[model samples]
Target: MSCIPLTQKSSDFLISSLSQVNPFNDTSSIIKWIEYKNNQRFEVNKIPLSKIENWYFEETTGNLRHQSGKFFSIEGIRVETNAGPIKQWSQPIINQPEIGVLGILTKKFNGILYFLMQAKMEPGNINKVQLSPTVQATKSNYSRVHKGKVTKYLEYFLDKSKSWVLLDQLQSEQGGRFLRKRNRNIIIEVPSNEDVPVYEDYCWLTLGQIKNLLQYDNIVNMDTRTVISCIYYNCNGNDRYDIDRVNECIHYSPLIEDSPSGYYLDILKSAMKKDEGLSGMDDIRSWSTNLKTKYYLDVNSIPLREVEKWRHDEFNIYHEDGTFFRVIGASIDTDKREVGSWCQPLIEQIESGVVGFITKKINGILHFLVQAKVEPGNFDILEMAPTVQCITGSYKNEKPENQPKYLDLFLNPDQSVVRYHALQSEEGGRFYKEQNDYWIIEAGDEFPVEQPENFVWMTLGQITEFVKHNNYVNVEARSLISCIGLI
Candidate 1:
């Protein structure tokens, strides 16, 4: 199969976005299947970091590592930045330099695209099971470094001969916990006639079904949300790509009869109106570049033993205040994963967080408030973050002026302005039962158009365009964007 044109891909997404029915399973059945998968035999027990098997701390640096030195490790880093109130700090961060792959497989059935989603289990999941990408694997797992079962359908992502790539980009993860971490977020489409075997724990659902599931909390995993956020629905001027013709193809079709109406319809309009944004794409890029050039970030890897203000005990490594997070060990036993059982280190958040976006209409088009945040682990030192991204518990005693910008708006929001709100989890494979209060609050008419120096206004269309590349948008923003309700 040849590569699908961008215009056709956008049209196909619009059709699928409007469709809720498919040949395979419905939304109710998918939820029930996830409940069943949660019941499957799996056990995860907290263990002492010193008791984990095949793992040891280096004598000189006190850095934790696997025996084979293949997987990730927990090390210490000292960060110095001029963006925040605190000038310097030391903490333990996950050092996983290898790039992982988070991919979704799609096939057209009855002229509507159906996505292949997996009911996968991760050791750190709070619900035990959630809908994930078709292929979510690290380099060590796919390469069989642990000598386990093969990752099913990984070949389609590895070899270009197996499928045609629809969307591909290198996206970053949590900069606070992971140091310079990124994954390949991609989507591919197979030939409609190809006989692709669907596993028992996996099913085919329309994009509309997936979006419907997003309305519910913790049903779709982080990997799935980040990949789906990369899906584009807009078409700018190009000799090769055309949006008008594509819109005309499915303009008046019955598929859109059940489409979203009130606020959701406004979201679709905001995504389609690329030119009506408050700031042009060029200006946003220039602002980002200016922030990158203006900010100062200096990070240095050091021995875990040398990290100040953090205590390392036999069981775990944590801070004196016990606010941010800690590193610990977990013994996992399960028959559903690639490996039957294993022991590894995991990062556990000690406090609940708030990740939100404040939106308002600019020139009659919905625009999202974004921040150019600088973190020590970011590859480019600056990425577009949500309006208010911070651990609420960490700022309880902080002064109002010192807190994150626009955080008070979500804390004391009016019931009428709350567009979308839910409790979402981070990647369960790494984080241990970590979750955040994800929100999208529509600013009232009285909200001002002017923002701070580090902030800017952008539309969903503009945000996704930046997401198509690397390190431009943070994972927190992408996770909230995936929860956008279209139907």
Candidate 2:
């Protein structure tokens, strides 16, 4: 068979046709066609220019071009050999005595014409030349070398319009398909008859076809991350490791070792049973062990304290004096005590109990000016009135007065003047006037005059009003005494 020279048009046409035929479909038929067409060639070597020339000369001269070429002629006479005329009469003469034959070969088959030319060669010498395959099949087969057998089988299935369900019945026989469980890709493992190892002789099918085969095998859960992790640790660690890639490989095959040791492993082991003859548990365990040793050993060993120290100095929690220092929020300090907006003195005073404000809401407006003492505790207790009555306005000025308002009762529990009036006077601005010293304009004077041990005194007018408003005499009088000057 002769080599067919490819033109740009023909090459484009062939590629387009091949593209239209889905490589994923019916790989078997394609492979069969390749084998059939390849058999027509005498040798597997790619066609060279010399072979084409020889073929062309042979067809034109009615002899293989080499057989009719020139021999060593003496003087001007043509030399004759045991074969016949050493040189064809039609050939042009040259000055060199050992000049070889130059001819062409032409052939026609099924209305297609082919041509080739041979260069000068020594007469009586058998020329060796590389021949390109005339048919497209040989080139296509060569292109599929890396794809492996599983991919080829998958392509066969796809070509036949078969679905993935059919792959279940196709048992992986000797020198048959191999599934890359981690990648969800198929590889063919063909046996070798030569001295070479079995794995080396295996021919690969197309990648697209292998993917189709995986679909048939229901091997869709491949994750890139786990696969990459497996490859990185088990294969060579050449690729960069990242979270996303690791997660992907985990999604598919369980061959990956860096995955969590849990129910996921059990599921993977069960699924792996389908390809039972390929690899054993020991092989997988060893691979996983290697991966762990390479990528994950340090994750569980490093101490938190060491890591923190390495990154930065320790975060101090105590002041120089051993008092606990806390990070107080700016918003809390500003809203609760306007001390935050003032200079350092105001802030220090608030902290030191020299000056403080009670947070209270009046008519739905939050006011932070009410004077109060901050109790020393985990929580600052705002002492407004002694029993915590809501007060109005900023008490910045009144805090220095030291007048015993309602709140003073708690501070000085033994004080005798309980019914003292906190009145805003026309002259003194505000003062606590004892009721006994004021006019006793009582509706009835029979009220007990003896001072109760824990009681604050009330005026006769206040007692009569208390009776008018309350249901019980003792309860109303006591309640009124509690807020004696709060208003």
Candidate 3:
């Protein structure tokens, strides 16, 4: 025989001729043969070759009952598929709903060949497994051989609607088999019409939420220092890179190295102007400073009082025109104090019925002592009755009793001492002693020089001056002889 050089077409013809001679027909018989080989090789006592052969005979001959008992026990065998382990019973049968019969056929049949038959018979209804997007994207990026073999044919199946083509088949070393590219293993395909719009909507909604949070005055007006510190503490050096790259696109610029204070102020002013609804920057700066200080103090186990003192010192930097800023800062400190220290004073006041009162005014604030006193008298002396009194005097005053007193007057500018005296007049008219002599005195006029026991005296003036001068307001003076007791 002459030697003939075989071309590509001739080689294919030869292979086709051999395949026709020993064609892959009768999947059940082939699977039974494979199972027999596996059983012999692995010594798997669970499914003997004899049982598989009988199952093949029953399936091919359409007489299933003969090997029912033997094949029925193999129904639960987990057949490995490219997608995952599918129960043998889950294998679809041609025009048959009996899962048990299908399972027997699967056990005795070549799984790949049976799957092809099922796919052909079911057509559109067969499962179209695919890889996840991440896997698909990765696989799309690079091509690599899997399991020591190159995938040549990229076979796919169309779903019912024919909208998506799923990668369902691949050429393996063994033969043509179901494909499961790792990247494509988890993929789910949706109609392009539905998924594209939904993804866009999700992105829009997410952006909207972020925009709304940024629109708030409190959030937008937050101090740049505090915000920067938080970003640094929370994100570390990563924030610097992010602020430069990501935040820059969003119009959030980082401070320049040599940026003047005026630049920051202008930025703040521009931000406020852009969003009229936002709180003033100065106001928010004060608030943010206090808030940051509080947060640090809370986290570091630092005392709140110490934090407040520091805040107070910071607030004192601004003048009166900066009162708003100062107040915001001080209010935070005061609120913290009230929350922390208010209970002590409340308890003391409830128990003792006497508490120091502090009042605030534009000119200044005042602190006074509240005293509870009782009077003992039978003549119904109004001056000696139990009263709630406010004792105000200079801190230098050692005796509060010697301080000037005013009655029934809410405001007084001057400090003066006055004496009240009464004299027993022979005539019906009222008399008072003056300079060691008895003289007639009117009701509203100043008293004479002499002092009388049966009278009341009161002094009115600035508390500091009265205390410094040792001025005594004779609020009330009654005759010791006329009253049985004095209080």
Candidate 4:
């Protein structure tokens, strides 16, 4: 297969990521627009699980399901995995069998690519509104399962005749909460001369502008981040360009120099340098494959009422010890959604989480420390995850030695080593007020190149390549990588 066309598109994306100036709206203007959307009439309040409209618990299996059985259902899954400390357990998971579309529309303006973003409101959002993908809808919603307004700009994705596909990949969502749920993380480029209509809630933004907003907390939603993370920017794919020549093709705007200690420049350099990684792609793949073979994940469906240690009341169903998350009900009323009013079940975490990635310069090229982790709901037995991905309750009272590998480094990190830190949210559609502390830490010079068997050092290019395929990179890792602010 030829990689020439993809390499050219990758180069264009890199330039857009570096360029700070956008022809349409500045970063501040985008913020003001989001604030405006947030002020619109939207309300969500917690109600009893038994009282949610058009949803009921199955009498036979005790599973929470929608009346029409189109959207999604809350079911119980018994998970037995050898990857983590816990061997077997049961929890409530979102059973959405339908694949969703998390697509971003793009067009070229003055040789720079601008992304179309929407200021959408989810029922469970803490901020009430955030920047979402242009079309974030499940197959059920797009096909009028809910019998509501049609999703705007969905034709470009459904009928490929209208646009050129730049990047498209099927990516997984939260494995812990979702049962092998995947979404189409796609980016399509429309011709410059196409007359695409712009609505009040949607706007065009450069990749640089989007990256700049990622520096803040809960501004860019999880769907947007995951879709953006699938974009691989290595112009040297298929050996099309030599190392020096590839560097020459990369142009960094002066705006990147204004960052603290030139960290943005370092990130840019790391992403563009596709060659000379710490480990070869063959080795990385073999390592992952071996992990997959070594570890085992067996998930079986069970009745929700039969789950162990979980208790249910009229309002919610939660673990007796208050561990990972709880299933509750929400009554939502919003003027902006496809359906004006609806009630559904939401998963509220016991506590906020910490998701971090540690990077180091290996042979003058930056490499991210990725762990091949196995969760119960993973489609495959293994997917590359962040170095530290854990909820507070998972290891709060555990001994320091028993905690996850490299957990203490982030817990008590040096201030200077912290490159990017923000309080980002999970998907607001099914999660309620759930936010996590996302971090990018630069490892000290003393950090060793050798890691555990399950962990490997990979360049950003390598990770991006894996992300292009299905079920290789987990959503948490994708979300963290999307926050790499090049601007």
Candidate 5:
């Protein structure tokens, strides 16, 4: 809610709390432990083209046009194409629907809340491990391979009779990006005095402790951050904005402050709340309805080579010579998953990237520098994107026009940045072994500005109002704001 520098007390609290859970500082050991458990019977084998059956390619292009299972087969289409009947692509789509579960287990200790977090390992993670949910169950998690072994503490979350659930919501994955994957995100609170199981790879952290982790890249996984973003102060049903009330909640966050942004921060806290709980894209019916009040995704596809301002090799798409990303295909086999996993083409970044927004207080109002951007997968033709969202090397590339806007301030920080961090990207499920760096650069009134045709400055209130609508703020911009990582 604020972008002020951390006070000495706040800084020491973060450092001390993290030191208490030192083993989890770097997740290498945790990853190894997970892999050790998984390797018992689960395995993934790369099938040669010869071993694959019930599959064939078009003679003209050697592309997989369509395929089917014994029971069912659905043709695929380029997600960007609005006018075409569904067509298939080079990689195969998972025929079965994939279900992922996100569970956040919490408890109130001495009148303050604490969350149970695990140093979870995911195959696609850049850091190999991160602070993940207490129970992050994909179909592979609860499948036959585990032999009905319920994920730890999962029974508590699922057993309506046992635990009290604070939040529950269904969120859709990126349709253009991810295959048919959806997750049921849940939050449960146990009794303060109850003795809950804690594993060696797990730890209890306060929200302030969790916020400190956000300062690092890939330390707090996307699922954890997204789930935390959905937790709002207004949801407590006592939405008072008195200075006394704000001071009381200071224990919940390490960034201790009093009477800073007072009324506006309260407005933001209330606005983010939804009776429906956390969501990925367009879950708020009112938000979605308002978004369509003007524009929607009028998508159409052209050849990768034909997309203006881009270049494509036979195997990849690039801003310039593989500097940003490469398009590749793989045969996936998480055998315990719903569809048991299948091959698909996905975007693999040339290098990890950053998505940043630079904010300045101008004329006594906080204003965010946002840009109008158009991406191949963007639902709307153009949305308000981050000021600088590009791979690290993009601005330094030989291609002059490909340079990102306002990247200099992000990379070279001075007194302008009140807070900044290289945060982690979401899972590699659709991104193909990729993670991004996110930055929030704060510039008080002292910062100067130049407005371009495609760029504009808006207040936190304005941005929050726009967020209620879909696509106005692209994911890169929304993610930076949705989580507590904003001005």
Candidate 6:
């Protein structure tokens, strides 16, 4: 990927905006940002938000006690596929019909752009609190709390004061297995002179600052990356390499380095000459929408049927064949949150899954080992997927000849060939608290590559480029790439 064209002054402005937070700034405020939660909690004389007697928790199923009546029941979905009748968990999809919005509130100050991030909490996050979107409100959340009162600056992005810029969109959630999900992605800019009050839970950050934080695992949350990746900064039109400018960039830039940045830029220029870039987002929209539609049009699978694998009581659910997930009920209370009190269901994983990619250099450029996976929910019957995605410890079901392509290489990974090895989470908000151990495995000329009926090895530059335009690279693949430190 060539450097998304940034001028010298703009680059400097971003680097300068990335200063460390001051601990003592506004120390007297009552609302606690998670960054200062420990410091505030240790203050022996601190004031409490509510009387302890007023807060409590209770577990309710079809009708749980002291729980929100909104999300009440859980059931199982049986989908008849070519493989078999796979029973999966099914719950209430989005409560409201209108698409929810996961928007970033940003502004420019002194020649630099700044993103507004919230220190928010979800019921299923591994950590109690993590960095979240400025406006992660659902259609229900907006109408309930923000419509008439409480949501002050929310008007600017909603419909009133002016500077709202939503980009080429329609980003979907990793199709909640048996369920579906999507949200409108917004990238807005408010005027610099506008005196927008910064809330206790919100903080401003620059692009450079955000990229720096990505180096450390999970600092910049997944929602943030999904939206940021939509940014199209490839606006330079010269269509030629400027070696002098590249050298100048290495001296003062925050991320650009001489050896790799320059070398990779040259590689991209030469490769792009041979590649036929996407027509635009039109192709992407079609690919995502028609994949499954195409699948149903061609192949015949087992039909969907309600089965006994799952049991539903008058007010609760139980799974007879428990291989997927377990649901637990909980009541949540927090003093510094937008919705300080609520009840919701949480998903807990029974076992961990594995995600890995096999890669090697082909014709002097990096090419990844890719797979074609057909999920019940895929728009097309089968879409491009990660090299190795299987439940941990179970790839032996292959019929001697049709086993998963590179199962052996991943099971026995050499440290020298592995790029990243860490446990990454599924969408905490939706999935019942599950995570997969992610890996990036490598193979070389010594280890021969295969071109099965559905697999192909493509250059790294090609993969990254296609991702920006469509669903060519699935979320699992994007998650692995987000961990890659290379720009």
The best candidate by lDDT is 1
391: Cα error in model 4, Å: 0.2
lDDT of 4: 0.86
Writing each residue's lDDT as its tens digit, candidate 3 over 1-487 gives 1112223212221122112111333323433333343232111111222333323223432222223232111110112222112111111011111111010000101111011111100001011110001111113112331112221111121122422222111100100000111111111123323322211101111111211222221111111101111100101112111223322222332211121133222221221131121223244334334433332110111221222211223212111222111111101011111021100000000011101111111111111111111111111111211112222211123354433232212222122311111221110000001011111111222323222221211111111111111101101111111111000
Tell me the lDDT of model 6 at 247. 43
Model 1 scores worst on lDDT over the 10 consecutive residues at 234-243
* lDDT tens digits, residue span 1-487, model 4: 1122877787778777876687589899888888888889999999999999999999999999999988899999898888777789998889999999999999888777889999999987889999999999999899987888999999988887778888878899988888999999889888889889998789999888899999988999999999999887665656322556555555443332233127766675666655568788888889899888899899999999888999999888999987888999999998898989989999999889889999999887789999988887789988999999999677877887768998878777899999899999999999999999999999978999889898999888788878988999999999999999765
Residue 257 error, candidate 1, Å:
4.1
Candidate 5 lDDT tens digits, 320-359? 5445455454465543333445554445667767678776
Quick one: ranking by TM-score, best first? Answer: 1, 4, 6, 5, 2, 3
Collision pairs in model 6: 60-64, 62-315, 291-379, 291-380, 292-379, 292-380, 347-432
Backbone-clash count (model 5) = 2
Quality of model 3 by C-alpha lDDT: 0.17
Give RMSD (Å) of candidate 1 vs. truth: 1.9
Candidate 1 stretches greater than 4 Å from native:
235-251, 254-257
Candidate that would win on TM-score: 1
324-431, model 2: which lDDT tens digit per residue?
111111111121111222110000001110111111222222111211222111011111111222122223334534332333333333323222322110000000
- The CA lDDT of each predicted structure is 0.87, 0.20, 0.17, 0.86, 0.52, 0.50
TM-score of each: 0.97, 0.12, 0.11, 0.95, 0.62, 0.69
Question: What does candidate 6's lDDT look like per residue over 1-487, in tens digits?
Answer: 1222334323333232332232222212312345464233111111121221222222222222112233222333333444213323233222222456667776666545677776655555554455666876666566663223354356755763466463435555553342334456666766678777788767776654554455444444566656654542211223233445544434455433323353344333322322332222344335444544543422222212243454443222335555445445545556654555554544555677777877666555556666656654444455566787766533344364444657667777888877667766666554544667778766768966556544566544455555554445666666665554323
The per-prediction tally of clashing pairs is 0, 50, 13, 0, 2, 7
Give the Cα RMSD of candidate 5. 9.0
TM-score, cand. 6 vs. native: 0.69
The weakest ten consecutive residues by lDDT in model 2 span 173-182
Candidate 5, TM-score vs. the true structure?
0.62
